[model samples]
Target: MRNSVLLLAMGMLLATGQPGLADDAELIKNTKADHEENGRWYTSDDIPTYKIAEDGTVDWPTFSGFRRYNAECFQCHGPDGAGGSYAPALATSVMNIDYYKFYETVVNGKQEVNAAQNLVMPALGENKNVMCYLDDIYSYLRARGTGDLGRGRPAKKEKKSEAFTENENACMGE
Candidate 1:
């Protein structure tokens, strides 16, 4: 009778699925769903295409971001963040990027690693809605600057004077 009971217990263990297996599958499914959502979060439709209309109405908080960027970051980043050579161009930077990243970098600041001119950014956590401002500032800069903001690299520079010849008659196509 004892041997029979042991056999039965072994059968049950084999027949029943192991505990926590379902949880793993559920976790995988949840993770996949989250990735899908993240992929769509930055779609073009989600982000506004135009910064300012011809009439000169700037996007909300974006204008504020511009003010803050100019006041706080322009010195190192340049007027439009194209680059200054002395400092990494925000337009072309691959580090501490994006609204969330920029906001965090600004608010928390950063530690200088190599004693380069780059200084630790002071935390602007005190600033209200700085994230939104950073987002708008990013949009404005990306819209005006030449580069892919998503890639965090500037577009290759084109040859200058290609379009217009040295001759005054170049536009006439003579």
Candidate 2:
């Protein structure tokens, strides 16, 4: 009976374009009372929402930046972001496209340069953070490997050491 009354009152409120002062008060009271009992009216301050920029770039760094290079470019570019046998290494590529040109292609997706290669890149967008990340990736690639960003660890090499001994002919009695 109480539920029916509440529903009827809400329905009447909806039907009436202009709710009176008492109606509004009743609505608020009912909502608060119900919410207090059900705990369904709580508000959350944080929500994850992706906002794409006008240029199609993501507002935040996509894949935190590195992942973008890895997922979209690493296949042909190699782990270092340097072009492999299948593609031109980023560091030494003749394209020499600076951040702006590179950004254009990234935001616009594939371009018609070297159509014979049949490569079709997709746009990433003009999101400042994302673009900044791209710059970081570029910096990483510029440092050495085609992969943008600084090399995390130096390449390893085998070490050799020797000592002279009285019993050994190679060392003699040094």
Report the CA-based lDDT of candidate 1 relative to the real structure.
0.46
TM-scores for every predicted model: 0.43, 0.37
Per-residue lDDT of model 1, residues 36-134, tens digit only? 121111223243222333454444333444555677677776766666645567755422233445556767877675755555556766664444345
TM-score quality measure for candidate 2: 0.37
Model 1: ten consecutive residues of lowest lDDT: 31-40
Q: Taking the candidates one at a time, how many backbone clashes does each contain?
A: 3, 18
**Considering every candidate listed, which one attains the maximal TM-score?**
1
Top lDDT: which candidate number?
Answer: 1
lDDT of 2 by residue, 8-61 (tens): 999987888485666543432221111111111111211111222334333222
User: Residue 28, candidate 1: how far off, in angstroms?
Assistant: 25
> Looking at candidate 1, what is the lDDT of residue 109?
72
